[model samples]
Target: MEHPAALAGPPIGWRDLDRVLVVRPDNLGDVLMAGPALRALRHAAPGARLDLLAAPAGAAAALLLPEIDAVLTCSVSWQEAGSRDVPVAADLDLVDRIGHGGYQAVVILTSFSQSPWPAGYLCRLAGVPVRVGMSKEFGGAGLTHWVPSPPDELHQVDRSLHLLERVAVPPFGGRLHARVPPGAVRAARVLLGDRGPYALILPGASCPARRYPAGRFARVAGRLASSGLRVVVAGTAKEAPVVAEAAGDVPGAVILAGELDVPALAATVAGARVVVCNNSGGAHLAAALGTPVVVLFAGTEQVGQYLPRFVPASVLTVPTGCAPCRQFTCPYALECLDLPPERVAAEAVRLAARGPVRTSAWSSVREPG
Candidate 1:
């Protein structure tokens, strides 16, 4: 499947890239962090038809970006193992589809730890002329341009942007962006009901290792309510029990679990004075909407690398000997995740001082019926 590069000149040039496919099959937060890089790619080649390949969850946020002309979805085995158990036929079909896309180049965006060579191999299999990725260990046969991943730990946004920089994409303001659906504003307004200085409490994370205790979240919500700020606990429908536990009978506290779609949730975050949550997608969404945040830095990952950098945020984490383990299952029963609710509450109050900044630039594409 290796199509030898024509001997006319260099391997590839940015100006010659007309249609491109950028692969980032991860999660919501990961996709949002890559927002600036995506915009840079589009800006560098304004005429190119830029497409994004994201996971199902990531696809929702990806579509919100105006830079992406189209979006394709796939849950990579490395990222989401056992999520899709399709046979080899399905994978081959995708390769064939990508080959037919008529893309002149393909770029695979991955985290510093994750290897993009496998994804690059897919692009090669699909007959993409130029394949680009970051791989320090192994990538000779996988990619045409084997750029070295940054050695130092950087913010996820910076990491993605760095990859684009190595590939010749010019820099832009490091701002995260996501579009709010047309109906989101009205829906959010209806739920909030003329509330001032409301605080959003995200009580769940994609993994248990990243989630704070429900009781702690409840205490934080109560504290916020006591401070005269309306508290709204939000998460997916599956997180209803956690959200309910956190909002339990708190005065002026609303339970909005499973109530809003991605755009609606973004709208709600945009309206909130501050969002208090574990290291999760909600934190990233708030960053994109320019809202302040109080991020509970669970010991599952490095705080410096994953914490939102595009917005004002106060990150809280208990110092632990084995912290930043990046393990999904904590052998020590998550001793590092226990932080005083009062500390989180204080940070939320300080951040909410900015007051409710309600205006937004998110224009929805269509209204839900």
Candidate 2:
């Protein structure tokens, strides 16, 4: 389904784009990294309705971006290949819904390893007049603008802007963005009432390969808490056991796992003295909130590519032969995240001095239910 521009003259793109749909069917961290590109789209099409197509978890996180007016969620089967839950009909319904959205352009941003043609094809099927995507392969007829993907080592934040540049959407800014809702800031204050000099320990990661042992996290938290710094261990509710293993027996350790939503989490990160986390979304979120971090850099990906930037960072990772494997699980017994708790604690303490002190922000607030 080639657009009229292909048949008439030069290929279609940003020239007359309105009601644009940005598709990034990935995790929260990926969506957060794409913030700069989203802002560019908002700037280019000021009055246009900018909708984000994200995975369910990504959809929730995407709401934090002020540039995005709305989020449409999809847990497509291909995202979790061989899953019996998502039927073919579900994908068809997504096409139907998007077709009725009246979008003039669809920009498909993908990771270096991911193929953008499938997403471009769906947008084509939806009759979006202009389909823009990034890939190394020839885009065939599915995409009107097949922008070549940048180097694998290019940061996800930069990669998004590179794709948009092909469509005349210039770079807006080079900063990770997330608006901390006032209500969520209040919630953070209530949850962490009167706690002074707290360090946030995020004990969970998107995959086991990236997760440092819960017991190791506990040791770090215990060391920090014992030093009169309140330790706040956070994760999803499903990470309660991991959170407990990290927070239990640590005096004055606050367990906010399952308590903070995206906004609340942003506030909590903003209010913390320092954040110790894996190479995960929490690391990005903390960076967006202007907090220093001590990252347990699992070697599944490049250190410079994903490690949070624009903030002071202390990364702890062991050199491994199988680095950049990009595997969900480490075959080498997770050697990359094998840093000692003492080292992690020391880094956290060092960063805490440089990180912000938000005791004044905790002065007054209602409790979170």
Alpha carbon deviation, residue 231, candidate 2 (Å): 0.6
lDDT of 2 by residue, 1-369 (tens): 433333232544454666989998888888888888989888887878899999977887775788888888988655775436877798789899899999998888888888878887888898987888877777588887777767889888888898887667889777887877778887887888864678899988888899999999999998898776889999999989999998868876789879988888878887778889998888888777678899999988898778788888888899899998788888878888889999999999988887555556443222335
Question: Which pairs clash (backbone N, Cα, C closer than 3 Å) in model 1?
Answer: none
lDDT of 1 by residue, 290-358 (tens): 789999988777787887775789988887888778777678767787888998999999898865444
lDDT of each: 0.80, 0.82
Number of backbone collisions per candidate:
0, 0
Model 2 ranges with Cα > 4 A deviation: 1-16, 82-85, 359-369
lDDT at position 303, candidate 2:
84
Best by lDDT: 2
